[model samples]
Target: MSIRPATSLSMAQPTMEGAGVHLHRAFGFHEPRRFDPFLLFDDFRNDDPAAYANGFPWHPHRGIETITYVLSGEVSHSDSLGNTGTLGAGDVQWMTAGSGIMHQEMPKGNAQGQMHGFQLWANLPASLKMTEPRYQDVSSGDIPTVVDDDGTSVRVIIGDFWGKTGPVDGIAAEPLYLDVSVPAGLRKRLKVDTYRNTFAYVFAGAGRFTDASAPRGVLLEKEVAGQELNIRDLSGNQTLVQFGSGDEIEVQAGPDGIRFLLVAGAPIEEPVAWHGPIVMNTPAELQQAFDDLRNNRFVKSAH
Candidate 1:
């Protein structure tokens, strides 16, 4: 029942991607060991339609899985395999670009000119990198949502939580992805697997993660003079909190409550050679993948 301490905290950096679409990158293209088995995370939230309307054009991905979770907008997607669909609010699309696949995503805002969503890239292990490309689209109603007596709500996206299973399964990484919301001024303790590497992304509101050596609560908003807290306090939107080894996490909601994504995964402790979307074990293997794409042999598996 050890409580994980916040190891690092930072805000998502504003970055332009996907044909000039504006988005905030929490972490990506760096920190291999920081969040192993997970390669990238981006927060595509915008209130102005012009910022996201350009969308992501056609792109190829290999040896990775991209999980797109939409919160308020719609993401229309089409892949080379003749798969096409639109993800509305609360919908999730998990695309496994095993051997290879080219896809495009176009985002449309709501009537109020608002859009919000998240996309996470999980690395495929060496064994499954070239298996076959696949897609899993789960709608909002299919996702399990649980509410606790303390007003803490959790939406299990791709793993076990609160004795419930997520819609996504058979993943090599065996990751746990949860969308958590804590009510105002509520204190909650959530249990996590002791062996998994964990992190939390605060998308809305603020809160404090209690540390073993810190005072009673995590005060993320204001700093009091002479505060004898030896713990990390996390707050504000787009804040990323990386946790240390522990079996559980404790958080106290601020006056506005807190909402964040809690993600954990077993580290893929293997040698990694990564270049863009293609990840392999060696440089030669990466060159081989690029050669295959250039030779128009990217689709090795018949969809």
Candidate 2:
């Protein structure tokens, strides 16, 4: 029953991606080793149609899983396998680009031209890197949301929490993805697997994730209650809060409350050979993937 201490904390960066879509990049395309079994996380939020209308054109992915969760607006997607669908508010699509797949996502803003969503990339292990591609699309209605008596709530997206399992499964990472919300001035603790590498991304509201030593965690020192802390709120966003080896995390929400995603997974610990969007175990395997793509034989027949 030991509580883990906060090892390091840093905020995400404000970067532009996907044909001029302005968003915050939590981590990606640089030093991917810090977080094993996880590759990239993009916070694509916009309030203008012109900022996200162009969207992400067709792109290829292999040896990985891309999870897209939509908070508001809609994202219509199409893939090379002839699968197409529209993800509305609160929906999530987990696409496993095992062998290989080409897909496109175009975001259509709502009545106010406001769109918000998140996409997280998780790497597939060498064994399942070339498996057949598949999709797990979970609608908002199907996702279970549990509210506690203290006004704290959690929407289980993957793995298990609050005695509920997320709809997305069969993943190699065996990860736990949770959307947690704690009411103003409330303290909450969640249990995590001791062997898993866990971190939390605060996207809405504000909160302090602290250990027994640093009970106050961090304070932006200036923002009013309920407003989104900007990048300058270094004490708030961008800081990656890494925890020690423990099985539970304690967090206390600010006056305005807090909402964030808590994710954890067992480290692969194998060599990572990544280029562009493809991740393999070795350089030779990476070259082979490119060769297969050039020869038009990226996908193996489902047996």
Candidate 3:
């Protein structure tokens, strides 16, 4: 068994998007290869209503899937396909922009004037790029939450874990998304597929993802608990921790415990021509998408 350690950690950056809402951008438009099959991650969490009320207006997306997970506030979304709905606390919306789609998302804080949520962009492989646009709206109650005896809870959003499957399926990336919480002083080893690239975004508390990646079938059990293989600086409030190749991950929570979203997927390993919201395999294809938008030929159909 190999333990994957944190390869890189970075804090989110404050940026304005969609009209004028202020949000933190975790990663985007730079060094995207490190996060293959995953394009960007944005934290739209805010305590002030004014900072998020403006929200994201109309936008276009193509050759990608956008996953929105709401934590405390509500997100009212409307797409060109005539789908309109409100996502309350703990709700998730997985929208696949196969060929093309335009949508808008407006956020409203809860009673206490707080909004917290995340949006992750997953790149689609070329085979499914122009398939069909669709939505998988998952409610909070529909998601399964598993609680361990040691006060550790995990909410599986996609893929199978602990004998339970997520509601969202048929995704090209076949990603595993989870919301995890570990109690103080608890050490846990999360299972991960060695074939996939994995990452964890810590939004609450602190923890250290031990750095002990063993090559192939080598067994280094003692190195997992040893100081030589531990990464001491992976605990950041809004940090993104990218892991190396390994079958499992070990995290030791701090006094406050740790809560984060663990996401992993198979790499696309294809050329990415990204321009704002549109992502294509080639530069010419990207230009054609923009040209189609200007000529009213972007979307394949309304429904």
Candidate 4:
């Protein structure tokens, strides 16, 4: 079993979105090809109600899919297609804005005004870009969570993990999205498809990932996982770890344990022309999407 080293690693940058809602952007709106078949990943975590209550007003999205996973609090959403719902804590909503759809999301914090969640955007292939729009609203109870013998729990959100399949389906990327949490000081080896592009995002706690060739014990914080190890090493939060060509990954949880999202997908390899929520293979196609939106002919009838 070969282990691949991590490539691009960076701390989540502070960015505000959705009408002044404060959040952290892990990666997005730049060089979409580096993470092909994937577009944006935003970590919307805040303890202040005023920072998130305004929420995202009505916005148009086309040629892509948006996955909203609520770690805490609730989000009430409605779309132009008349679909509406509320995502409570641990709930997940996968919306395929195939052609186009105007949507609005309003987040409500808990009694203490703590709101935390994540939203990831994935791109659709050219063939399916103009398909009918659809929604997959999976409640927390509907998702499959598996616990290992070592007390590591994995919640399958959008793809296959640990012999279980997520409730959301019909994705163009054929990606595997997993929320994993490990107990303190436990070393775990997880298998992944060798052909897919893989990356892990540390959301809570810190851990050590083996396979990088940058020398051992030279712990890296805020960027790579190795630079200088210390007792005060809580630097993995919001850090992205991209792996090289490997079929399995090894991770050793820190004393405080570790929790993260491991995502992988088969690259589309096609050219990407992105403009906001719209993505196309060529500039002409990108312009066509805008034209369709301006003419009110984006969403097509499925029947």
Local accuracy by lDDT, each model: 0.88, 0.84, 0.87, 0.84
Residue 38: error of model 3 in Å? 0.4
Question: Each model's TM-score, in the order given?
Answer: 0.95, 0.92, 0.92, 0.93
Candidate 3: stretches off by over 4 Å: 213-234
Error of 1 at 117 (Å): 0.5
What is the C-alpha local distance difference test score of candidate 4? 0.84
**Model 4: what TM-score?**
0.93
Instruction: List clash counts for every candidate, in order.
Output: 0, 7, 0, 6
Scored by Cα lDDT, where does model 3 land? 0.87
lDDT by residue for model 4 over 250-290, one digit each (tens)?
88787788899999888888888889878878999999988
Clashing pairs in 2: 10-238, 10-239, 10-240, 11-237, 11-238, 11-239, 12-238
Model 2 lDDT at residue 103: 84
The most accurate candidate by TM-score is: 1
Question: What is the C-alpha lDDT profile of model 3 across 246-265, one tens digit per residue?
Answer: 89988877777889999999
Candidate ordering by lDDT (highest first): 1, 3, 2, 4
Query: Which 10 consecutive residues of model 3 have the lowest summed lDDT?
Result: 214-223
RMSD of each: 2.3, 2.9, 4.7, 3.0
Error of model 3, residue 107, in angstroms: 0.4
